[model samples]
Target chain A: MLVTCLPDVAKDVGANRILKTRAGHFHHPFGDPSRPEASERRWRLEATKKALEVLTEPVTEPTVFEY
Target chain B: MPTNKKIRVVHYVNQFFAGVGGEEKGDHPLTFREGPVGPGLLLQRLLGAEGEVAGTLFCGDNAYAADPGAEAAALDHIERLAPDLLVAGPAFNAGRYGLACARLCLAVKAGGKTAAVTGMYPENPGVSACRRQVHIVPTGDTAGGMGEALPKIVRLGLKLARGEELGPAQEEGYLPRGVRYNAFAEVPAAQRAVDMVLKKVRGEPFTSEFTFLGFDRVAPPAPLKGLKGKKIAVVTEAGMVPPGNPDRIPGSRASTHHWNKYSFGGRTELPKGSFICIHGGFNTVFVNEDPDRMLALDALKQLEREGVFEKLHEEFLSTCGNGGPVHVMKQVGQAMAKEARAAGVEGVVLPAT
Candidate 1:
């Protein structure tokens, strides 16, 4: 499983499970400097949790779970 | 002008096919014969009056595998015979024999003086190793398929020897070498694409002009029971590294060695100016301002304290994902997996750029 802003790339490359983070950009998939430090940390925590959640789901094909 | 001269051919076979001994004679040295031997007889008959099996070259499977000079010796014999084509074995599933045939054919093809062709099972290791460098006709897994395989090999060999423009793999009946040749299509690409899209929408069967080679699908491992006490590791291709770029991981096209492990044992967050992103594919300013954006080190540490997981792995694995070749990246991934497993890491979070 991987976290990426470019979910299409991950899906095209055949990643079985992927977490698509809306809050992140290509440069920083987990961080958004625009948000306050606490808010950014909270978003990152949620994103990481979503990535962890993705791993527990059974996937027959490349599937993107949005965060 | 088309010359009337018969297409002179040199045939290659292992000891077993050459009537030398079987596995025992696998160590037999390279030997040359004046005319067709064993399967070469069939190859010659298939060629009829258009080609001649001028000479035969045979070597032990082990001999070829053990002898680094085997290819040079074969080339010398081929040069002396001056054959227009070199037809190696329909080696089938014989690993060593298949490898030898593919390698010798690759050498002959590289010489440019003679065209070369061989046959092997599609799954033969040799096929993957040298398919792009040589022409390999697909055969069955064993010699039982020779009757069906030889005719195709002979046909392809003759065309290659005559310097003919061959068609695509499906049409030519050879393995796809992954090299694209430019050819005029009946319709423009834009029209073809539209037709394909319409066909797809209409649920009609249509063959796509271009086929994408897909990566092998790996079955996902069963997920960890829970993160409560599991040791999770953070891995990234974000190119985050300590100041000064200690390992000199390239900004792109990073090979296996470029991947490195770094210790973030006690750090709550990656402080500014302490770590930097060297990835060439994206602007690094945002990540450089706060490295945690790329690695999530701070969040992971906080989670660790909150009992989200037992403890964060002391070290995080990293490499620049920007433009890394697929093959090298595969090796890097394997190496990182091995490392994580050895360290008893239960789960990994790999954030990619």
Candidate 2:
């Protein structure tokens, strides 16, 4: 479960498609990737967490992406 | 007067109250043996001179909730001899027990006995579900309130037997079972609202004049014929680990939050030192120490490599054991499905919470 704080990385992964939500607990919509910010990472993390729970394998590790 | 033949009320209770095992007992369904057992004795003791529990029925919550066909068959086994009224555990807050009571009371009342069915309650969701059909009187939260509750319920039953016009719930001190009548009051909503406001302003007590709610239990589809070699994915509401502990996957719907995920890739086998938990909105605390124990990633990875199913999907979905809201959960589910589909995964195996 790669907890990407950015949409670019999350969207890049064919697996993180489930984390595509614009809303947060505070009832705020997360801006799209073009307008990326730190909070979007939380949403991406939330999505990643949920998606990863259903995975049948442990994520070996997350490699830092320069992009 | 031909003296009294006491009203025989049948009591139903789950395994816990019956002094049987808890969840384990509720796993079986509908069997009948004559005499009373379980909470039946306590109920009979409470009824004293007014009523006698004719019989008792016991079943597991899992069997009923998981398999209603078995539940119905079990009920058939219990209703061998009709009593004046059928009683199920007030259930307090136990969802399955409360539901069983509500359902039994409803079925008994419907079986053509003008019998005054009653259930004790402490606001189990089932109270709302079966309140309208049966005399599901409200009560305090535990068995401690049973004594005080019994007489009141019995009184309601007597009124039904005597054909006496029953007063409003508050007037009679019985829990409002939410039963409605056919007679329509002539007052319009405007007038009624005004009257209600006046009473409230005067600090006068008032009762809700109407109550009827819907209850639908959707049956689950049958399980796949055989799972001997299926590529099963175990999901739980158990918060696998502490928050921000690197976002481990979820385990239970009713459990708590924890983080426990670790990275995975070309591992041929799971590294030791990780565990899983059973969370049913009960408690949370497992993933804080390490991700390997829960998140079950290591297990899945090993299984995938071993050809557990065919190909293991990458990136499991997760959340706090708390009911992940529908909107976000569905989005996450769709994402997982997409991933699983890509990896050629099949049906999932949701661990029992």
The digit string of per-residue lDDT tens for model 2 on B1-353 reads: 12275766666777676666766576866555455676566667766786677667777777767776855765565466556666667576677777777777677667765365555554577766655456666777777877766666666766664456777666776556555546668998789988988999999997656743322222222333433355444342334333333444544342223322222444433333333332345433322233433343544554455553444444343445346543344445455556555555454532212
Worst 10 residues of 1 chain B by lDDT: B210-219
The segments of candidate 2 whose C-alpha lies over 4 angstroms from its true place after superposition are: A1-67, B1-3, B114-116, B120-122, B161-164, B173-353
Each model's lDDT comes to 0.88, 0.51
* Residue lDDT tens for model 2, A1-67: 2222343433333322222233321111111233244454444344333433334332223222211
The residue pairs in collision within model 1 are none
Give the worst 10-residue stretch by lDDT in candidate 2 chain B. Answer: B212-221
Weakest ten-residue segment in model 2 chain A by summed lDDT: A24-33
Error of 1 at B327 (Å): 5.3
- DockQ for all models, in order? 0.60, 0.05
